[model samples]
Target: MKAADLFEFPASIPFADFFRADALPWQWIGQIKKALASGFETNVPGSIPPGVRISGEVYIHPSVELPAFCSIEGPAWIGEGAQIRPGAYIRGNVIIGAGSVVGNSCEYKNCLLLEDVQTPHFSYIGDSVLGNGSHLGAGVILSNLRLDQKPVKALVDGKSVDTGLRKFGALVGDQAEVGCNAVLNPGSILGKRSLVGPLTPFKGTLGPNKLLVSKPETSIQER
Candidate 1:
């Protein structure tokens, strides 16, 4: 399938140019950091509120809200109306979109969160692009490293295709919902409007309008 089948270009909040994929979609992962840095060339206007520790260079819109204990490392941009709750750590080179929520205990880096995306509560998202309105339930993790610590691969059309990147996380599509405690293995791709059940360890590609549930059936005898 083509890249356009998985991502909706209109849903992108910023850095829309990065979505143009001539070959494989994952090939654009390397360009994310560069795109983020260049956004600052236009004199990005922003302000930093109290109790927030800032390092490097951060471009935060005035309408963004940062609660206490929010630490941001730079080459990062926080969009309008974005909410970074307490204990939210933005490692570096992160693009948090407008009206998005990076909740408490969520650690993310080198990622693009589309508008209205919610990665709240104990989620680890790295080196990935989350589409608009996608939601990661509590304890959901987008894993970036494989066991070998080498380049991650994606299982597309029953083939394991190498992504050629040592650290690459999942590409979650627009309106996808990952249930609580779900772990998305490296190089996973979820198409638009997909659902991942709670406690599932997901890998490979799931097309749009799909529901994946992975849980062992529980049997109760007498109490």
Candidate 2:
């Protein structure tokens, strides 16, 4: 699906020109690096905490709330008013939009987190796009790589389409909610306002405003 279908590309992020609205959603993953390289201006916080280690080309807005301890490796951008909780690990081509929460113990790489996204605890977000207002429950994992190490294919229109990327994760659409301890398999797509129940291992594409629940048996229900 088109990027516009999933994300609005918040105005708070300066690299919007690199991510075209008409482009495919998965295509936006590859643009993360290019976007950072082209427009990123390094502006770190003035008073760095003792336990927080920041390295490489990074930009942390003045209003970003940094925790006491975290490791942030760059080519990364942390937007205004973003909250970086303790023990967070941010590395490589990461973009955190305004007011987003880079939760405690979260590991992020090659990802784009749009405005107001909340990944509030113990999550692994890599090579994925979390849209505006999306929330991930504790221990949510966006599994990026296939076990076989092959290209990740997305399920579009009920057909498998090769995304051509070996490392790809879920495209969590605007305002979506993923429950605690859920594992989103490689190439998963959660449409806008959709919900994935806790403790579920979800894969493929879930449409807008839907709910995927596993009550001993997995089922898709209208939200």
| lDDT of the candidates, in the order given | 0.81, 0.95
Give the Cα RMSD of candidate 2.
Answer: 0.8
lDDT value for candidate 1? 0.81
**Model 2 — TM-score against the truth?**
0.98
Cα lDDT tens digits for candidate 1, 1-223: 6566666654434677766745466755676797776667322335456767888877778776668678888888888888889989999988878889989989988888878999889999998988889999999999999898988988888899888899999889889889999999999998888888899888888878888887664221211
TM-score list, all predictions = 0.89, 0.98
Cα RMSD (angstroms) for every candidate in the order listed: 4.7, 0.8
- Which pairs of residues collide in model 2? none
Off by over 4 Å in 2: none
